[model samples]
Target: MRTEAIEAWTQLYAAVGLLAVICASCAALKTIVELRGGTVAFPHATWTQKFLWFPRLWLRFQLAYMSGFPCIMGIALLYAHYIGFAAFNPS
Candidate 1:
């Protein structure tokens, strides 16, 4: 039972991390485009419409290049590690 629980948690973490990384990666791409003098459309006026990506995902919003990729990667990694800790360790 314990092993099964850990296995399930590992899978869940992998899925969540993969999704977050993918989204952040997409945002990173947009960040690059913006950096290169290309404009990425916001496409929304209302705050909710703009942040419709996933709850309050900061990656859904534009961040400065200096803090964008690094911050995104850091957050993704942080969650992955935390989940890993919680998911493993036989109890």
Candidate 2:
């Protein structure tokens, strides 16, 4: 039982960590691109920008992604805790 829970918790945290890394790196990349005079993907985005806009939303998509990022990740953490992963338990 303990081993299984540990494995599950490990997997859950791994996924969450990967998601965080990807999000941050993508945001940084988009910022760098913009700093280099490239167009930001928002408001008047191109067709391609529409599909790859999530990370760029850090500074481009405005309030939605900015607020949604923490909200979404928090929900994921709550879900992990609700699943009986003791490692994820907040209290």
Each model's lDDT comes to: 0.59, 0.62
In lDDT terms, how accurate is model 2?
Answer: 0.62
Model 1 has how many clashing residue pairs? 0
Worst 10 residues of 1 by lDDT: 53-62
Q: What is the lDDT of residue 10 in candidate 1?
A: 70
Q: TM-score of the candidate numbered 1?
A: 0.40
Q: In model 2, what is the error at residue 19, expressed in angstroms?
A: 0.5
C-alpha positional error of residue 31 in candidate 2 after TM-score superposition, expressed in Å: 1.1
The most accurate candidate by TM-score is: 2
Q: Count clashing residue pairs per candidate.
A: 0, 0
After best superposition, candidate 2 residue 7: deviation in angstroms?
A: 1.0
Instruction: Give me the overall lDDT of model 1.
Output: 0.59
Candidate 2: Cα lDDT at 4: 65
> Candidate 1, residues 51-78: lDDT per residue as tens digits?
7634333453444333455655676567
